[model samples]
Target: MLKGLARIWFCWSFPTMLKGLARIWFSRLTPNSIDTFKELSAQFASYFIRGYKYKKSTTCLISIKQWEDEVLRSYIAHFNKEALLIDEADNKILVAAFTNGLWKDKFLFSLYKNDPKTMADVLYRATKYMNADDALLAHEEKPKKRER
Candidate 1:
């Protein structure tokens, strides 16, 4: 557990923990610009909080399409990642968006044959399809035995 770690130590080490734009932002700051942890935290919040304030709507999910060559698993993963950023997205809307984005395939055919009412149902069904897709890929990758 952490012990004897003082505020000064935290202030000094904070910049090292940052990456990408944050690291660049910290590097650009004038030397000795931050005097206290509270001031540093406040400045960090003020600089980055604007981006966090704008939450994407469910409508944004409608624009996400499963690319021609993208696997079902990857598309579902990407869709789920973006879906998490939305605040209280409706289950029905999520299902619709997810279904709309999918291209014509076994999964899409399954979805059409047995339509899902909730996002959870859609994900559950997708899991089965993803496993099947993986199994098919594994089988295809195996070398065939030559006939004697």
Candidate 2:
């Protein structure tokens, strides 16, 4: 998957995933910059969803495919699962560990109950734009009841 991620870098003409990661890095800033953060979220949404389904698509899937061709397919013939976790104090720090792999370990976790830890689910819930965790970490906030 690292290779897939790498290809996205090239496809998007970015040397690195800095733009996407920046949302996590410099989230503390003036309100003017929040719009930029939303753009970043839209930019990377493809990477998580159907990036390869349409033409153009910011070429995110191209990056993923490129990585699949060069590294992932060769390194990990089998697509495995992995776990991801976030630091309690700082939810931005993502922690990943290996659980399984194919010929070689491509992913860090296996697909099972004891699979590697995951933070994507939780992260999605917490973030408002790309890295908005302020509301998420607020446990004291009351939830609105759904209409019956």
Clashes of 2: 9
The lDDT of each candidate is: 0.85, 0.34
lDDT of 2 by residue, 1-148 (tens): 2367776565456324455334444343344453443575675574446533212222221122223244433322221111111113222222121111222322322223334245454333323222333445575588789999
lDDT for each residue of candidate 1 in 31-82, tens digit (9 for 90 to 100): 9887766787798788787664336888999999999999888998999988
Clash pairs, model 1 backbone: none
RMSD in order of candidates: 6.8, 21.1
C-alpha TM-scores of all predictions: 0.65, 0.15
Model 2 residue 2 CA deviation (Å) reads 39
The stretch of ten residues in a row with the least summed lDDT in candidate 1 is 1-10
Q: Candidate 2 — which residues are off by over 4 angstroms?
A: 1-20, 27-30, 33-99, 104-148
